[model samples]
Target: MVFSNNDEGLINKKLPKELLLRIFSFLDIVTLCRCAQISKAWNILALDGSNWQRIDLFNFQTDVEGRVVENISKRCGGFLRKLSLRGCIGVGDSSLKTFAQNCRNIEHLNLNGCTKITDSTCYSLSRFCSKLKHLDLTSCVSITNSSLKGISEGCRHLEYLNLSWCDQITKDGVEALVRGCRGLRALLLRGCTQLEDEALKHIQNYCHELVSLNLQSCSRVTDDGVVQLCRGCPRLQALCLSGCGSLTDASLTALALNCPRLQILEAARCSHLTDAGFTLLARNCHDLEKMDLEECILITDRTLTQLSIHCPKLQALVSQLLVVDLPLRDERCPATLPHYRRNLLSGRVSSIILGFRGLLVGLTWEVENLRVTVFVFGCEPNTGTQVLTQIHGQPVE
Candidate 1:
């Protein structure tokens, strides 16, 4: 046990190179690449082909609003495996084509919000990157259905696809895509308004491996489409229908009953949703972790309380009712009620209440079952001075 400092240094040098490479995997692509500039030995290790299996160019902060693809291509040529360029708005069609041509080995590619990309870029990507398994084109507004045909022909191994907000794509494009990419595990089409029930029907017939589907803001999709999707994709683990106005309780009920493994649901703006829909959700989808029902006016306190009781793992719940409410009271109410209400008022509530009416008579009332504080205001008389009153209710406002 009398090891010297020199012996310890020699033992450290004897460490396996595979162990050093494993440690490099945890470091971000930028930091790992930066290590290359430290010393010759570090540069050789960092620039090794195996070390470039997953490359993220999103860290290029200099001139962030400008194209960085050329710099990326020059720095990590032909070695990228997983590339994510989310929010890189400066990347145009040419830059994307260049990146695709060079990084043909990429398996996971996320280009979300890269607005400058168009249909031609997809064609270029298809021509080069044939090994792509995961592709996220969310919010790429300029991309059209023609790109789907190219992607289907090029990337045969694509397993996960996200085309959310690509409004230019219609049922024809989606049908072609589903038919071509049979192994797709996750498909996200949120905000794709042009996609109707026909697309889901096609998907049901084809992509059986789909485990997650996000149809948020797809206004044209009705319960009929979701029924078909649930019946086909039996292993679906998560579904997001936030802002899908056409979906009713029937669709959600069917999904809850059939898709037993469904865990996360986002039905934030489904205006037609009622307590019955939520009840079905609580009973069937017992493993649900997060649910967003923010603007669903029909969601009373009963539904929320039931959700809390049944879904014990529920971590985040967003509801507009939990924020603020307004209450109107009669002028004949006793002054004693106002004293109790005044004590409950907060500075944020006072500012909003003052803008409504000049005066208000405080009163307490129950809406559903949750407690809420309300503000009351009234217009002024001949003197042009308004009156104000604040009220707190034991139930939801």
Candidate 2:
């Protein structure tokens, strides 16, 4: 029953269309919906062409259909810059065609779970909207190489594309994308098991601007494939090779040597990697901030010490070091002895304390089952933990 400034409604008609549009822009989606019910004038302004620039119909996915999107697109009058239909399962090729026809100015479109649509939508985009910048086809199994070819031929301005879990796609599809979209920056091919070295090789050959690549669960991508990928794409920053069981020292070596801007690397479940692979990474990749080495059974204390000495900014170390059998030669022993000691007494890894080499000289880090605190070198008895703790700052436990 209530509305914005009831007295101002009387003079709202006198306001210029541009000013009215600007004023309507300040209202949130909920407020605009309420205003639409107030009167005909308010309704017209509420659904104005300028007001529909970014339509996020993801929340209304369960309730809305193609007609809703069509209506919004018509109201937008080709100014819909960003549209996200994240889980609108009912949307199909016809709905996308209608959207493409009306919202020609749309630059970013997210149809992550729109399963009913196929390559027809891609063809529609190629025919109608050529300037699309971002597209998410996650889990859209209906699409094939034809759609990728269509996108490659038309969407030349495409920058970010997510084909994650689209197992139907092959090397040819991505090859087309690489050839068409030169400025492509971020590409996610997670779970694209059908693709092998050929896909990455082609991308490295053409898509020079690529920065972040996620090939998690890509079983066929061997160390040779990754070596080639790293050799070409030098500016790569984030790479996720989770579930890539075949990766070894060769892949890590290539990444360390080539990708100077590398920051995040998720190598979880890469069971073949050992201490040598990580040691090479630490020695070369000094800028590494986060690294996931979970399930790497062969790694020990040397790798952790290398990371601590090399990567000054290393923040996260996703490793199974603490949970595994606490071996004396393990990397966690030297790098995080204080943590292990704390956890041994308490439930969680308390702070063991370490600064001067692997052995902190004070804590009883298990010597033949008996607790024997060893004081080696100039470290007196009580000052060992204090001196090191002061140097390393507060306790990490």
Question: TM-score: which candidate is best?
Answer: 2
Instruction: Provide the global lDDT of candidate 1 against the true structure.
Output: 0.72
lDDT tens digits, residue span 189-241, model 2: 99998989899999889878889999999999998889888988898989999
Distance from true position, residue 307, model 1, in Å?
3.0
**How well does candidate 1 score on lDDT at residue 150?**
92
Deviating ranges (above 4 Å) for candidate 1? 1-46, 61-71, 74-78, 320-397
Model 2 residue-pair collision total: 7
- TM-score, each model? 0.71, 0.81
Q: By summed lDDT, which 10 consecutive residues of candidate 2 come out lowest?
A: 384-393
CA lDDT, every prediction?
Answer: 0.72, 0.77
RMSD in angstroms, all models?
10.9, 7.4
